[model samples]
Target: LVAIPPSLLPCWTIHTSQWSLENTIRRRPLLQLGDNSHRHLNPSTISVTTEREEEPDFADHNTRRSEPIRVDLPKPATRASTEAGGDDFMSSDQPRVVESRPSALTSNPVHEAEDEKDHGTVERPLVGDQVRDVIRLIQCRKCSRPLQEPVTLPCGRSLCKHCLPETHTRENISYPATPNRLQGFDCPYQECGRNHAVGDCGVDVILTKAVDNFKAEMEKARETITTAEVSTHVVIQRPSAGQTGTDMDDETTSRVVKGGPLVAVYTLADSGELDYNSNVTFAEVSSLGDEATAIDNRTFSKVKESVRTEMDCQVCYALFYDPLTTVCGHTFCRSCLHRVLDHSTYCPICRRGLSVSPLLYRESCPSNEHLKTIIQTFWADAVLTRGDALAAEALNRHREFDIPIFVCTLSFPMMPTFLHVFEPRYRLMIRRALEGDRTFGMVLPQRPRTANDTHFVEYGTLLRIVNAEYFADGRSLIETTGISRFRITRHGILDGYLVGKIERVDDISIAEEEDLEANETQQALERYESAATHQSEDSSTSRPAMTTPEDLSKMPTSELLSLGVSFVERMRQQSVPWLAQRMLTIYGECPNDPALFPWWFASILPAKEYEKYKLLETRSVRERLKICCGWILEWESSSWSLSDCRIF
Candidate 1:
């Protein structure tokens, strides 16, 4: 009833003349040139101003971006709308509603939907480029062709599987997803130009099917063209005078000769309009054809349900949050695949070796982007529910304290520790850790001096896996960085490796009393430094008293850190080869930050493993630093060397 500029709003409305119920639409740009350069953008809120008491949601049906492009919608327009289906398409019953949802296509379908049947699902003929848009959605954005066995990358984009780079793919070497992130090509999408690695790629099952449908549509269109060209013939007439071919006459038509070619005859006779050339075109032909059945609300729901079934992870028997596909052409959820790989490198469904495909790279791999887009497009509510459930599950994972423990040498927070995963049980533990949160407990075995002593020390550091390189014989060399300390509440062995229910070990905050203690320690350290200078100068007096662990422990955190820093400075002055500039670059120089200095000192200190575990037992930063200072003092007093302090 009203005419207005199309650029006023961004709603894409379907024609309601064919069959009116309601249409599925989303908020998309009418004309976006590149990036944020919108042609006619006026992003201001527009709501219905009807003379009603209150309106819970003032947004019209046009601005909703809830579902995918293919949608059948609107349940019923009722004020007391309890149904989720009906809530989406409810527009105001007054004039302001039309302006609220300005259409880019035709007029607003809401008024046209008033004179309609069928429960909320509007049926409109797929006209113009709508059918082609469906085909475009599945096409490879890079190669400008239908995706051939499409592989989804972490960047939420896809290209042909054959198009993936093969430079880093090797059989027995380390995984690119582990030791380092693999270098990749520029992203196909203009919106995202960042490089995405092939090591983080997964086969796209849903897009592959869409490509097949696209192929079928092409074949059908060609057949239609061939039939149209070959199915008809032309009739000609021998004109007596300079006259063109007229209407059919029994006598005249009987004596007429057959035409050479239909096209040529049309050209010679100068036909007004050819029936074949009237209006039909290949681009205008809908992929589903004229006989395409319109889907109602119930049928639309059933279709999504069927697709959801395909999207479910077989291992978890739930909706796939991040689905991944293997080189064996099998697709499964990322976490599910992780669980399967824990036992063997073979695919669970196909029993084919998965070593050919890149392993799960949590830091880089984002699983199947196409599948993820489809899931979010179709089941926005379900995805939110799934995300919440997974988050809770991940939180419970840490809180429940059913953690895998690695019985190894001592480790400290912010310090790196390398381990050789030759033992079968520890390999499984590492796999489980990588799959989950990339963390596990690291503790030293007890000396068993007392009968009450446990198999391993109670206190340990939680190691977060940084990198791992695998061997063909099911062994791996993992580089881990310590996260935090933990104390085991209960312990037991599962499948040969230890599993523990542990509580976190954190430092006691220092107060004024500790500051006073630090001042006293500072005076004592000054006295010792003078005494050591005197002893070195004289050569007749015995060495100054060694600072025992107990004495150093009583000192404040500042004193301990100063002692360690002084020791490192003295060692560097003496030209200790490992403390050279190159070594410092590799291992990092003595950190000026007090919170980090103790761990760095602990990592490089040439103390015994048993002695190092004492650092884990303490809940005070002062005590930990004191332990490191004590080791340096002991090393100096005994004239011991740090020749065995290897970087490995």
Candidate 2:
């Protein structure tokens, strides 16, 4: 071994050491660091000679042109020749053939693997047919199952992946095996409780290959036995002692004629043209005659039991309906898995991430072909059972009304509302709504004394969700427009959400007499206001008279209309200030019709709830108009009084 200089020491590492200090010093020349005389010892001084190939100018159809990816590959190690220098650990001179390869000095097992893979010289166990026996013998000797994706340790024994116990690394030695620190995982085989770095413990690839080959061989052997049984037939004959030549010829001809049809029938059965009972054929009942009847019955019973267990869904604990296997290798009923993924993008049992792309468009996940075939082949009855169960469930859901309610802020007809659905109950409620009618009622909650006593208002606005965007965590942003107002007749909880049996609530129909009276009141008020304005010296151009309670009986319909119309015009002109502009922005220009104008003004005003509630109670348009006019007059008088005080 040659000593490296301090300047070059950082560039080179001591990869391997096999000799004692005394022996190594005697066998190799000693070089001191930072010595100008030993500048040759510097790694920078050594020139590497590599054969470079010129890149092709033209692009190759099969290859992509890109910069060469840099890899930290370990250089192959070389042992000194016997003639040049003796082995430091050897007493006698002997030459041994050494395969030049990278030194196994990497602390990271993953890097060690990459080096071997790039060099293409993987170490494999030297066992032929014995590989099968080796794997079986090394089985999680505790449970006695064949080694599965075996992890071999220094003990030379293998353990199934799951049988290995939790491991800990040097960093945070108290914490058990975690995904991030798995590189330094320790071997947990009972017999070999050794802390083996993950990459150091090579997987049993050779054993895996051996096991696969053994299974293939067994399958081939079974196929061959079945083919032989179907093709081969035995025959026996005994000649009658007192048979005439003509009688024997006729008997032989008749037997030969019947054999043709029998051969054709068997051929048709083999080709699947005949609908023969496969179970009977499998048990060789026909070939073995009546003696095989008992054996066939027992075989059929065992087969039915195995099929029932294998074809059942783990999630529902029932027969699989459209079986699907997730990326995590767990099989589930397709409908069951779809419902799970609607709320989550992970496998229910394993919590492993599952691809949600298919489910997003409501497409079925990839089916597990093996499970599907098994159900079709040995247990078609399970398919029928699953269908029956699904139908019954659907019927039950149908029997119950599926109105989903959203307990949120108040909404009104023709208004747009945006909502963020994060709560689990609301998320589910939205999904059910989208699945069925794409409509849900949005209601405000009423004040309750206790949490459990939460109740919503009787009347709510039904909203039709136009579009919804769902996030990965089951949160959704939905855009909805108010459909119509509905009054809850009966309310109850369903699936963690509020539901109500509701009837649509329409605006009260206005009577013709009420419209005529509203006109009459407007005319009378307009005349009385004109007469009072002529008599008052303080009258302004648009300002009207402040009639007393005594003048109420004499007021005419026209003057009242004048007051209401002037107030509305002032609001639209932005001259009269109001607290809220939300309704002004949303509803645009106030309605001009006498019948609707009063109700529209009442709804948009930022007035007391009791005042607005009173507006809804009045069925007559004239009455509502009267109430609104009084409110406007009161506000006008209050503003004037405040100005008069400020002037004084």
Candidate 3:
């Protein structure tokens, strides 16, 4: 629990003794003689004096400005109040003055003095004065006295001259492992408020020095820890079972047999499901025995036959395993199709030229309708049994967990492809998300396909759906904010959509430092404001006025990027090569780069998706900065040389 100082209390105020004459004056309004006179004066008379006359000389002559008017009147004989019905007249006019001692409301020096004494010893210093005094007191940690001669330590502490020698000695001699640097020194003063090591001064010099040393030590420690942790977590790959000796293999085989019949049979059987013997060829099963026996044999034979037949390519009437379908509705097993196209194009079925290359079966036995059904059944069963396990693994691996997956717009081999069709389950998922978090993770397939494909970038940001409107055509327009980067940990098929587990990554140090530095840099950038404003003023072309340092600092990073982008464009249009180059150098070529120069340039230029993605994915700020600087330099040199040569 942190204790807030009494001085820090919201309503704490200095005592009366701490108040100065100026403070008293500010708190109480002055009683003005003019105000009193104004309040007592007749309103009509006041208005007549203020009102202007049409003819000043005539008005003045008629008004008779300063004389008092006197009227002759009859005098009445004076009589004593008792003789003239005393009580009623006395009560009606000339009321008697009641003599009373002054109340406490009136100011009195003695009473004020007593109140001041009761209010406690005059605070030694007012609140503002106390703060300054405290600051002086805290100046030098070693001396525990006001810093008469302030000196800075590399650790950023300010120390008095008297304490510097002792601190320096301790800093030099103290072992790196020692936790206490000021063990030998006692408190600098007997009446010190807090005891501290002589070397552990809270002065700016000492503090800064200590901080630098500490940072160096921490860096070394971190490196060691990282090396040790990484070494311990090394992953070793085991050799294939085929590489082991027969004796070892046989032993493993025996263990499998002991484990279970299913394991033993699967271990020995090719394909793990079927077996063949001379006496039981697939072709000889039809001729087997009498009516009942023959019926049973036929049934079994038919099942096997169906399996074998489906294994052949339905389009070619050959072994169908690894079959592929083209966009033109032509189907072929993998090898046959590769041969027919001659590594070229055109569909074999409809004779329509296939614009896309050969497509591989996304699923095993894709051409077999029965096989597809069987596979789906098995897949559903597997999902039912192991979905929780998969989800848990994905979570641990930092992949998207429990969400509908979509395919990439572009396809490549082994890459997950997005289908044009949005299934009901996925629509439900989207609806649920919009009603709730309104955010989702996207993950790219390890291998992308080139044909009608589904692939995404490896790392993606959390997209916040800002607006979503369903159109009459049944499409949605979604506006989103990219929040943070995430990495995919695992992926699996769930009801025909991809499901993944994703983990969020945060780089705090860089982000915070960048923010601070950006603020400072923006202030420094204000020096260019005059140039910008002058250029704007001189030009007939309309442009935004130069932003103030304070305004630029207050703007969001994104808005700043936009401003920089716009400035760069205007400079380019004006043929202000130096300004354009400077802008390009400052903002990197990419969003993730130290600057946005390159990205801004590329935004104006024609760049491929892959090229843009490369820039977006480049995470190193230093590298991005270097790249932008290089581009700026090249552009500058070329433009300068060209301009010089043109003088001829």
Q: Which candidate comes out best when scored by lDDT?
A: 1
Error of 1 at 468 (Å): 29
User: Which of the two candidates, 1 or 3, achieves a greater lDDT against the reference?
Assistant: 1
When 1 and 3 are scored with TM-score, the better candidate is 1
Candidate 3's error at 205, in angstroms?
23
TM-score of each model, in listed order = 0.36, 0.30, 0.26
List model 3 lDDT by residue over 1-648, tens digit each.
Answer: 011222232221122233233233221122221122211212222211111112211221123222111112222233221211112112232332222111111111111221122211121111211212212222344543334434432122344556644332222121111343333243343442222233333223222232233233323433433332111111112223444222322322112111111111222221222111100101112121133232222222232223332333333342332234443333454445644543234555557554222322222112322222222221221112122222332232221143333443211111111122244655654565565555544433345566433355555445444444344554443333344445544445544445544443322222223334345445444454444455644343344343233444433343344444554555567775343443333322323322334444433332243433443454433233333333333333455464443111
Q: How does each model score on lDDT?
A: 0.49, 0.43, 0.32
Q: Model 2, which residues run further than 4 Å from truth?
A: 1-402, 449-454, 466-479, 512-565, 572-585, 594-603, 609-627, 637-648
> In model 2, where is the ten-residue run with the lowest total lDDT?
253-262
Q: Relative to the unseen true structure, what is the C-alpha lDDT of residue 551 in candidate 2, on a scale of 0 to 100?
A: 44
Ranking by lDDT: 1, 2, 3
The runs of at least 3 residues in candidate 3 whose Cα sits more than 4 Å from the true structure, single-residue gaps closed, are 1-426, 442-455, 511-567, 570-605, 620-622, 625-648
| lDDT by residue (tens digit), candidate 2, 370-474 | 344334433332243334335444333322333567776655555556677888878877776665556778776677677645466656777776655556887
Instruction: Write model 1 residue lDDT over 39-103, tens digit each, in one string.
Output: 11121221211111222121211134344444333332322212221211222321122112212
